[model samples]
Target: MNSKSRVVVWSTGGVGSIAIDAIRHRPDLELVGVWVHSADKVGRDAGELAGGTALGIAATDDAEALIGLRPDCVVYAASGPERDAGAVPDYLRLLGEGINVVSTSSTSLVYPPSYFHPEWRKQLESAAEAGGASFYASGVFPGFGSDQLALLLATQSKTIRTLTVREIALNDHYPVADVMMDGMGFGRPLEFEPMLSTPGFIEMAWSAPIQLIAKALGAQVLQIRGSLDRRVTDRDLEVAFGTIAAGTCGAVCTRAAGVVDGREAIVVEHIIRMARDVAPDWKTSDSDATYQVDIDGDPDIHCSLTLGDAEGHGAGRGAMAATAMRVVNAVPYVVDAAPGLLSSLDLPITLPRNVLE
Candidate 1:
């Protein structure tokens, strides 16, 4: 709605690259500038990083320079340690400059701020208010998969007693390395911290999801519980993506339970691991990957949902790009949204018309 119709991309990593490919193919959205933290990538063509023909959008390490341009929006895909620290400043700068933003920086931030760093959340809120813009964080799994699944289940009946969502992903090697290597309990034994302590890693990163579903059901959440379990191996082996390096075989399961008005009404579970020739469990291990969701309500009513096969990133680059694409695509609508700490629940689920296939 700014009429500028230009969008900037920050970073060009796994998710960032995907977002670039998605943006490059769109006619309505212009790829104006690219921000890179690594000095090596600066001055490089953004199109090359995205595996496309050069588009003349050179990468720069300067955020202030990009902010000065005042693009309509920025799609943030930057992550890692820098995300919590340096990324915040960039976000604030863009917001303070009155540029609308949509990002996957902290995918779950679009939800409630209870589980997140309070200081960071407040900073974002302040930036948005000062600049008269909107911000949202989104991703493929939590933003839509488990969180939305629960919300959809709650709608089937008026006497819903309990809600449960279970996801089985035996092909997500990237997340395993991410959680094990960079996650809180990596070097230390799992017993030391437990899954509950690292809900930010294992379970959905956003606390707003539980709160959102509870509110939608006309109830207030009283408590939340989480647990994590990992399947270990002694020898390294190569899987679909790459080598597992022995010692890290099997799966990681994270479970979160939410109590509404002193009663357990929500249970969210996620399982990510390497599944090759055989299923981890004897009963089900015939396929490379399988995703399913089960929601139970009063009278044992259950809705079984399953996602069809998706190679590599599970929906591939398109699905990965969709996470950021949908967010940036929603900038125009979000700018017109009511101010305050907004929730993904507050945004529309449909993709905008301008985005491409």
Candidate 2:
């Protein structure tokens, strides 16, 4: 009981809330503090903010207050559009304070070697080394779906020809209007360029996983490319976020391909639909959240992973829970690892521990 790692939830937002509950359920973790952005959440119990009973761990806007607790790890889940502008400084602060940070915030940090900001990486490295702490980045899509699972599936092969990880998600139940409607351009016209369609956006958000995979396989990435294909709704469609009017985009197929040895050998493809049947021509499956990994080699292999709630619905919600737990599960490993910016490749298998019901 005395040896359990002390944990601080950096934000009680989307994944942060789930992370708190996950930490509370873990026998090896003791939740000591919660940091929230919203002023209204300042005095609320962490459990109430996480949509549960009172946990007695009140939320605070003061980051330094949380730091005063001297937690072993901080689940930095605060996220936004300006990720590079926001998450980096927070990571530096936590790492410099000798606190291990496991986050789902920055996709660039998924594999820091390929990060766009070399200078920032250097600072992060220096901070971690100075404070003797480790920083890790991971989450559902850019994380497990795009990187680890495909890399694991490749172990079944002797010689690899091509590897691909595809996310076929029915986003109808995903309630984030900003991400689905504005960011992904689901309800926007073809002329509209949503956040995901912008040039260099996909590469910025997903290239890390490609580079990670390419590096792990002893392959060099000469170029990373991105492309987008959209499907318009023939009729008005209603979704969890809102309605997609007829003639607007209802689904999208976004691909980030890593060119290795003059071929797109490593690829991360996302086929997100406003509804299950929106993109019938695509690999729309029965499940809401399904990840498909395809490897072509001496012996080909294909795998499908799905996530769902207990009631068999809200696959998106289940994905949120999974994302939180993934990083929560990694807290112990990150704390135990050598002080540096650690990637999934750096750590042993971070299995779920002491959470079995």
Candidate 3:
């Protein structure tokens, strides 16, 4: 019998927990270790922590201990707000140790060579070459649902003019306080500058998708521009994270556009709200949280994707699952790839294993 691929799940948060569940259930993969950041989760069973039955594996906060196990691949699902200083080194260390990586921690790394700083890119490239390991970064939005899926749909078009991808989500159901409240400034004063509004923040965050789409279409992006706007709530609202009182920031609309030859050729927009009613004037999905792609071409195509459990996991949790699964499903392809940084454009079509069974 062929041996299963040894894997370790790094972190167990919104996305990491889902990755743990995926690794544990896959027949072709073996869950060897789990890395945690919190002291409270250090000794807990990986399965139990991931909202599933107990698995034999235990979680640990010690990064060195997990690295010592020398797993074939590491599924990196750590959160990425204000973590660049530490996260980049961690990725380099893992790659330098000859362990391949499939990660959702850094969206910018989705197409690093095109958008990331040259110094950081050089470090990662040298590490992967020296260790003979590969690194691939992805997530639901910057990964498949936006870039890859849009490119696939474009293949059917007779002519192409412009493409726009939008992510409309109800943040009330999203549980991450650091991301929803702090990073997004969801409940802050209207005048406050959330992390997303910082200069170049939107361009950096959404550059991967814009670049990916622009490259796929053989278009050179001459410039990238971004915009951010927000709305205040009229009433106090309770959410999974906390409470958003009246007269506070309750919704955010942001967009990054890629310009080619003095025209906006590709764009990625995010319309997120603490409640459905907060952004009633803005476009929304048919479901609570939706990803929509619109193509303005000869055929003029529009695609919408909604992932959530109508009966079980809510839209927020379901979106997290989709993000985690996108990384998990790419593990095999990443593992077999040549040693270096990889983008969705370079990878083969990846599908979930044993999803039907």
**Among all candidates shown, the one with the greatest TM-score:** 2
* Cα lDDT over the full model 2: 0.87
- Name the best candidate (by lDDT): 2
**Candidate 2 lDDT by residue in tens digits, 269-321:** 99988766776998877778888899988789999988895443678778888
After superposition, which runs of candidate 1 have C-alpha atoms over 4 Å from their true positions? 1-4, 175-178, 181-206, 234-236, 239-249, 276-291, 298-319, 354-357
What lDDT is obtained when candidate 3 is compared to the true structure? 0.85
Candidate 2: which pairs clash? none
2 or 3: which has the higher lDDT? 2
Global lDDT scores for all candidate models = 0.64, 0.87, 0.85
Query: What are the per-residue Cα lDDT tens digits for candidate 3 across 1-357?
Result: 224678999898879988888888899788999998889998999999999999988899888888899888999988755655668898899999999998888788888777567798899999999999999988878777788888988998998788999988876766688787778988899888778989988988888889888888888997889999899999998988899989998999999999988988899999988877896888966566788889999899999888776542377778888888888888888888899999998888877778887
Write model 1 residue lDDT over 94-135, tens digit each, in one string.
888888777777655757455467888888889888988777
TM-score of 3: 0.93
**Which residue pairs clash within candidate 3?**
none
For each candidate, how many residue pairs have backbone atoms clashing (under 3 Å)? 4, 0, 0
Ranking by lDDT: 2, 3, 1
Q: Kindly report which residue stretches of model 2 are placed more than 4 angstroms away from their true locations once superposed.
A: 309-312
Tell me the TM-score of model 1. Answer: 0.83
The better-scoring model by TM-score among 1 and 2 is 2
